[model samples]
Target chain A: MAAVPELLLDPAIKIWVLLPISIVMVLVGILRNNVTTLFLSPKRTVPNVRLLKEQQHLGLLRTYRRNHHVFISQSDFDEKFDLFKKEYEFDNLMRHYVADPEKLQKLKENPNDFNTVMSDLSSGDMMMQMLKGNLANYIPQTVIMYWVNFFYKNYIVMKLPFNLTNNFKSMLQSSMNMIDLDASYVSAISWYFVNLMGLSSIYALVLNDNEMVTQITQQTTQQQQPAPPTAGGPTVDQLFNSELEGFKITDIKSCFTTIHDRVLEKYQ
Target chain B: MPIVNPSPRQPIVIIMSSNKKYLLNQYKTSQYLNLSPPNLLQLFNSCKVFLATTNKLSPLERQSILELYFYLSILTNHDIEAKSTLQKLKESLPLTSKSEKLAVLESYYLEAIGSTNTSSSTSQEKKDAKQVSSSKKQETILKELEEYLTQVQTLIVNDENKSRAMSLTSQQAGPLSRMTTNDLRTIVKRKVALHKSFSSIDTYVNQLIDFLQVNTMDPFTWNELGQTYHKLGELTKAHSCFMEIAVLQPLNYKNWLQLADLEVELFYSGDLVAFNVLNDSILHYLRAVELCEVLVDAWIGLVVALKLIPVSEMEKSGVNSKLKPLEDLKGKYDQLLKLAAKKVNKFVELGLVTDDKKLNSVKAVLDDTK
Candidate 1:
């Protein structure tokens, strides 16, 4: 480890190589947000009324009520519970509204439907979404990788401030041929990847949770399958069932058992 | 802040993710201090360091604090500060990532406030609110409503809606129809806040009722409708809306408070003709306090409701007002006053830069009440 030699890097490398790559990544990210926002913010198109009617009740009230039950009263809870049980108990809703038995038959035949804008409702749109999302996510990344390799080649851009183990000697160097380069030193292409990862954090800081990246990933995965768990748009009956199921876990009654003590204890 | 959105009309509500305990406390405090903007500001500002600290405050909290600052500023007539604050919020906030409705509403209200003349005609539109139309017109209204709702659904959390309704000829924005559920509700609440005539609120109310007919489970929508009715002096209808909210959102003590407040308002409005309702209102306040003991409003509301029970009614119940019932009342009042005092003291302890005069008044109420 002590035998490893340090390659003195030119100050210009920091200015020309490191700085430009980071700036490019940041600029590209911002551009990506604008581009995606443009693509994402289209007016909603309802291709199939039947399909929409099915998807309307996914988690809207069920989720809201589960989280906010403490905000309502016992009578209110009972009233809602009764409505939930009457409509959504067991598989009553599933049979009546959610899972369309005829959906398979329609799919098997030449289903003439081609209007659902969201991929969930239309097979054609889902396929297109799959194609578009995968292309966008991967194409630029590969293109940039090859371009960085072609231009920067094998130049070591920066040295790590710390010493590295002999095991890291291979993986740390982006260039295999540069045997003289210590594990602490990074090649131009490898530096770009490292910088890309680092700049990704900056994007996280700027956009909260990198919601754009998450949305695309989610969209791509859910594109192929019609029913993604989160926003699957199950029928009203399904929503009722799920909400009823969720109510089992929400002990809303616990909020009022100690009314007298709770009211009196505050002053004491 | 100036991001191109599809629907500039929809108001966004972004509740921040913080310590759940703190967020709940904040929400309750916000409700308690609704009429007192200065105290609300002081309460929010008291946690300025904690709310702003990177680790202490989540991204949502950071965004929420700024939102509160914007709202509290606008409400208190700090127009210049609100303008600059709005700019700052736009430049460096979660306006990009969070619920955008409050900011949008704040800006919209500020503009609405700036020029009451244009919105004054809103009253005229509201008066025309109840002219029901032909069945064919109703069909078109329903069709347009469906389209608008679909568009709203697609417009992600931060995305805006692009409405074709705005460009529609007068014939299209039907007599009984206008705006999405959320937009109608926000405008209604705004009208109530401005103390405007109720004529304009009717159209929005009609639209909201129509929406509720379809989307019965939305508690906030019901609550908004209830508040609109409450403000419009339609206690019976407002009580129904609040009752719906209670049924839909049983865990929310707010619904109970609203119902209680409504009942009390009704009893008072009708010259205290309903002693049963007064008793019912007291029960609701008791429920509210049970759910959230820290809520000073519920405590105050309980005491006030009790005090409002006329001596004749108490005596009619066969309880001597001076000896037994009034004595019980005095004990409750003392406890409530203490709780309110404790709340104010807690705020001061937290270093809230509050209205000294208001705090003194609260104390004066505490001291002066023998």
Candidate 2:
């Protein structure tokens, strides 16, 4: 077992360094949120008619599959299922989209040009979206790091009033000129990170419940397809087919047991 | 120890702090509370003062303000300033705002306008032989609401149109991406609730049932869907809806009372599929009272259900175990009646229950002095 060292930090460090970094992070987050909202203007506000149609159909299918038994007779459910299967089975919109000669020609001529392909079925401006998300998350962090490194280098921001481990000492003393920096001490470079992580709740109150840290931390988890290389975006037909398969596998009867038994149970 | 001189609303501050626990109770008994108009006015003023003092009221708080104003105006008929409030809601609300209560209130205000206009037309028809044609005004308002609801339906219920609607709503002030499904479902429920015709309600039910298929956890929607059936005169489906609600929220006395009421309705209609429905109604009413003793509505429902239950069925259903509750109810019947009379007098003093039929109904039930 390794023994942990301790050092006490000055209360003055909280007011001077910690507060400034956190305030900066919170401000940066709000700025990024507003900027992101502004940048997506024309596309965000204008309805893409094709995408809307597909989504509405998907909603209809999902709603019907899950709850039709409650409202409709068994005969009606079966009839609707038959109609849905017939309409959506062979002429899958997504599959049809993949084979269009005009779309294929555009993709072939300029393989790297996402904007042209993304206009209709190819990913809904995914590259632009990814760029915006990454910029929002990483730009402030990298800029802040460089700014802090260049300005506050070789300066110890504060000393931790408690002792800590050698590993932590190395991390806290990254920019400090001292050879054996105290574990309890925080360099100005490292101080920025501690404050950045703690200012989420403060900004959430100010920015209409928008969290600054989430913009940075959860960027990698954004919707990106690692599926077939060419098909970059999720299409309505693909989702519909998958949802239909899910509906087929699970018996609705199992989810919905007769309510008569439920009602009778209380009586007994 | 005195940090600052307390405001005159000191008693209200204490009540506000104490009443947090009783909010659910208050929601259930808002009808009975509506009788005492002065108490309501006090509550409204206190809420208004608190809201004024608070920095940036949250959406939940705003929703409460809407509800309080709704009870004050709609229930108490003190809607003298309602038009200004309705205008305020319109001006402030983001065009694509997704609050369900907001959706309901929008329709309610419109409906109130329609009915009020109709009543005004007839009253003025006698005075004006040669002017003031306002009969078309009600039709126009109703038509506008119907058109708005259809647009919402296309935007939400139709999956193909949802993305388009999303893009359109993005331009609006407060329509967050998270509120898509919830907002749509709420719009559907509110629209159905406001539908004057049963056929319109039936059509809306198909969509509501489909939405509920996937999101069955929402109990309020389930109750709303059941009430739609109750309106459409489908007692079996109504019972099913309440039954589903009871299963989802076992401790909720409201669902049981609704179910008991449905059974009583069925007993009256002579549409008993099972001979045990009469006993079942009594059982459900008992269960409701047991779940919430403070539910004064449930007591009335119990009295109705019990009065209908045949004497022979009680014996067959093991009357011994249920005897104690019946005895307790009978013992307190006279006292409960007195409390009810006092409440009725308070309501009368407020001039709310002015209609003869309404007064006669209450007098028939609680007027045990004779």
Candidate 3:
């Protein structure tokens, strides 16, 4: 009878103490998992400078493909290409380039051509800047960062021990929560990656088409020459007033009569 | 006769030729020519008298002159008298010499008469009068033939043979009554094709069917009638005709195909419900498929109809519970694919790569499902 009160009190104290402790442990485990996801995730940091370099290389190749004849006049094209390359490099370093003396010289020499070239260069530069400004804007960056943080924080940091029985049960419950979290993240990341790839491919296609049109225009201008007036009053008037005109009239009438005669002879 | 005017009648003189030149010149100068219809008729009669006396004219020249006379009669609304005079001129000319010209003139005459009849429906009396006048001309031709026969009788070396020939000629000359319904139907079809006028076609088709009765059971004729009925939106009649074809030629794929097409068309036009009408087509196609399972078109139709009924609704209808039938169908499709593969294997064994790409694609889909 005396031992019954002790037993009751002992169980009550354990419930009061362990319940709060267990709640704290579970909450801390969740917080640790989230923190790891945030900080220690393997993130892809896009090198803006590297992207700019690659874009510049592609732009040069496109320009060459478009105006292959321009490459035949190597000195002129190379000088222009060098100027464009310098402008791009400056833009990369400065985040944006103001109209510099070299750029002004290029513009003055071929104002229309230079304007289009500069516009394309600036657009590519701006895109790179935006990518660098937010890692999440690029899918691979976000995915890598998410997984790295998740692995580091939850598995590595949250190594706390509890009584084996309780700890096993808590781990099981947390793992269920983890499955849902992992599914959602995977779905989002996959969607983002697919969309980003599609958009980038479309951008590439447009750029390719632009380069093709520019090259065609340049080649046509090179091949074409103005015609000089002939010795006659004009070729048009000569053609209209020549003996051929009289011959044509007779020819037309003859043609009609021949057809008429053939049809009549056949039917008759 | 006095000359009335010169310039207005110049065209008529040129058309009639130089032999009638004096008569036309007199008519142009005539004082009574423009006075009234009777006075105009008198002047024209004087011209005709002069034309009849002109003997030096060639046969072509005579035709040209007589054509002018008929033209004047038509312009003056004296069509009955014009037609009689033209018929007389036609008979007097050697048949071969004027046949082509006469055919042209007859077509013009018929067109003119048709236009005149259409223009004024006010006077039934005028129409009746024209009919009576035509009948009189026919009677006059018959009387001339009788006189000619009597004249021939006087010269006959064999009287019985002459009488027999006269009887045969008379029988040929009498009205042949009506054409066979088949001929009428052919004429109707030609007219429908040429004029594309349903107004005449409907009447002609009905006349042919009524006249021909059971003789009109020819599938081609029924098919044509069904098409015409369908065009007119007389679905019941069209259906009956099509059904008759189906009954008459149960094995004819074309008849079944047309019926299926009509059912779909009727369903689309709101003449039939989507469900009921489409099911009828589906059933027909199923029958067609049963007859020829290699019928890709029928299979396509079945696939389309089945696709239209939502899978969720099918499930709700206990279709899923009873999917043994569907499973059996799926198994059949699979078996068919296997058979197709075997057939392709035979072709492949002979080194035919033309169908290899398609077979490979089908094989891919099969493999993916498996």
The prediction achieving the highest TM-score against the true structure is 2
Provide TM-scores for the models.
0.42, 0.45, 0.23
Candidate topping DockQ: 1
lDDT of 3 by residue, A120-236 (tens): 544443343333323322243354436433432232111123323333433323323343222212222232223323332333344445543343232222332111112113222
User: What is the CA-based DockQ of model 1?
Assistant: 0.06
The CAPRI-style docking tier of model 3 reads incorrect
Off by over 4 Å in 1: A1-120, A133-236, A241-268, B1-73, B76-81, B89-106, B109-199, B207-222, B232-236, B243-255, B264-280, B291-370
B19-98 per-residue lDDT for model 2 (tens digits): 32243344445432423445555655654454456556566555456455555555445454455566556656676543
* Winner on DockQ (2 vs 3): 2
True contacts kept of 3: 0.00
Model 2, stretches more than 4 Å misplaced? Answer: A1-128, A131-268, B1-63, B74-80, B86-107, B115-139, B146-183, B197-215, B264-270, B294-370
Tens digit of lDDT per residue, candidate 2, span A100-213? 766656644554443334443324433434454555567777888887777667556777667787779667877565645557788888787665665556655665444434
Tens digits of lDDT, candidate 3, B1-370: 0123332212222232334564444334433333344545655665577577778776755665566566556555667867886797779765533232344345345444543233354587556656766546434433433333333323332332233222211111111111122222332233232222223567646744543242333566678788878888887678667755654555555565567667666666768555545544544544444445444444444444433323344445544311123344334334433443444344435444334464465345435434
Model 3, stretches more than 4 Å misplaced? A1-268, B1-214, B233-237, B273-276, B289-299, B309-370
